[model samples]
Target: MANFFDFGLTLDLLRLPFVQLALVVAVVLGLLAGVLGPLIVSRNMAFSVHGTSELAFTGGAAALLLGWDIGNGALAGAIIAALVLGLLSRRSSEYDSVIGVVLAFGLGVGVLMLYFYKGRASNKFGLLTGQIVGQDFASFALLMACAAGVFAVLAVIYRPLLFASVDPEVARARGVPVTALALVFAVLVGVATALGVRTVGALLVLALMVTPAAAACRVTASPLRATVLSVLFALVSAVGGIILSLAPGAPISAFVTAISFVIYVVCWAVGRARGLTRA
Candidate 1:
């Protein structure tokens, strides 16, 4: 058994710029995403996770095709995709179908474009599987700024957002702007997904965000409690995963995901036991 504590000590020793930035970005973004992901899952927008991630892929592809800045293309793609989902979510009836269509088409287009740009493997991998670990101070600064901005927005909207999430009909009846909340959340999620692709990769970002939160939620019914637990779990997973990956031959994604899965299983079991005891 690898000691994540000692493993973590190793990471602190090398201190590569890329690794440092990754650790910071992952910890910050993972904390925010885990805190919010459960709320999103409660609102039954799980599909939106997949949709936004695919759209992010398309954005990276476009950036590669146009030879523009990768981050710029990704942000643009994410914004456009989130707008579509936000609008569709208002209908509530056809939202799933619309999102599914968009996700599929966007993924197809991204794959095709990647095929056309065969030589841009580094960019493709960065957007797709998250291999780009090093960021200049400027990029790291921008990522931190985005993370801070997102954290602030989420904090400001937390109360109403939680109310609206648990019961949209009641919240709306109480005069909460559920529609606007949805739009804001979609945009935030879109941006977060784009940024997260840098650390967790598009494939694993949702796992980092949603899984820890889901696990925490199994143990706590109170929203605030769950949020706190979720953040804690996410931080553990990110920091632990980074530390594990620093060891001789470990993949960060696998380590992080396994930790998250373990947490989820433990929480699920505890929840089930409590339910049975109640019965």
Candidate 2:
């Protein structure tokens, strides 16, 4: 514990450029993930998260194969995959199968591309495992722009999305555009997944996007309160995880994932206790 304290103090003293940039971007992106994740889970779009992330892996691989930018590859893959999901959601019944095929096909394509790009092992490893320790100025700007866009779209679609998520039949009866809301949420989730890949890697993207919100949901039944708590939890995880990851004996992924899981467990226990008390 003493060593950990000293390590944290040392980090506070040395505000390196990469570390600063990473913390800023991670906190913003993490908050977005936390806020959106619960909505997706409550709406039963967890599989969509998996589908988009898998397709992102394929996009990154293809970009490498074609000598293109990896981030663009990820974004393209996520958007295309989101489009497929949006289309499938129209039928409702076929959505799961569509997601399954998209996941499988994306992984297969990624594997084949990785095989062809064997010489760039480091890049491949980073794309898969998330070795981006910092964002450049241009990347930071892009992240901010994307974050703004996501928030703007969500603001407009929030009501309908919430209604549809909580009760689609009721929402439809009440004249909510369920189909449009689904598509909008799909696009938002895709963007979130693409943004998340920068910090968490495709393999563990859910760590950033799902864990915090799920944890928040356990502690709060109210949507607004849960959203606020989720954002806080996500920021804490991102900033704390990044700092811990920089310590002498810790990996960032381990720190971030552990923090997220711990938060979830704590919330779940608290929620259960509250339930028991009520009973």
Candidate 3:
């Protein structure tokens, strides 16, 4: 019994600098994505999240070329892309059309930047798959600031945003500015996407933002409960994935995605069993 309980050796890695940084990264990304993800999924903007993340990839890649902070670069890219999408598609019902055009342009730009970059291969690869374990204190601090800003804005706009998301026509009929809210939420989602790309990489940003919320959605139709559960699921996936990555050769994103997928599957099964699933 004593031998079975002896688990001290495996816990030593938690004290390492890199591990600590990764944990912080995981927490910030988890909370940010968790908070914004339900809103995104509710509005059927999961595709938009991917589109914005790819542009964020372009921005981060360009930042690597110019020797700037990749997170900030990604943030810049997401904001620009989201605003452009919102502004251009405000009066049009063909948002998918606009997103498709932007996605192509964003990917092309990212490829061009990667083509010309003379940095270490890991630096370029990190934009696609993340490199949070190597982050410094300054970067960590910057991440905290970004997280704070995202949460602050969310706190201010959560209720109206929820109303707008659930029913844009009803929200507008009740005097809510649906268009303005959409633009604001788009910017917020863009910021969250940039932060997600920083930790989970461009290729897997949606894994964190969409999967956990989707899983939560499957289990509960109550928006409040669903959002809370989504946050919990994201926290588990992010932190659990980081912890699992303490093992050699384990990629954090892979673990995170797997955990999220498993959670989604479990929730789907449960929802089906309870007749919570409509179809």
What are the lDDT scores of the predictions, listed in order? 0.78, 0.81, 0.85
- Candidate 2, residues 1-279: lDDT per residue as tens digits? 564557766566348787788888888887788779879878877778988998988898898889877777888899889988898667878889999988999998898899999555767776776654525777678778888999999888888888899999999999999988888788889888887776677887777788888898898878998888888888888778777766443445566788999999999999999999999
Q: How accurate is candidate 3 locally (lDDT)?
A: 0.85
Clashing pairs in 3: none
Ranking by lDDT: 3, 2, 1
Ranking 1 against 2 by lDDT, winner: 2
lDDT of 3 by residue, 65-153 (tens): 99988878898999999999998886647888899899999999998999999979887777888765647787788778878988888
Error of 3 at 46 (Å): 0.1
| Residue 37, candidate 1: C-alpha displacement in angstroms | 1.7
**What TM-score quantifies how close candidate 2 is to the native fold?**
0.92
Best candidate, lDDT-wise? 3
TM-score of each: 0.90, 0.92, 0.93
Worst lDDT run of 10 residues, candidate 3, spans 1-10
Superposed by TM-score, candidate 1 places the C-alpha of residue 157 at a distance from the truth, in angstroms, of 2.1
Let me know the TM-score candidate 1 reaches against the reference structure: 0.90
Error of 3 at 199 (Å): 1.5
Query: lDDT for model 2, on a 0 to 1 scale?
Result: 0.81
Residue 141 in candidate 2 has what lDDT?
81
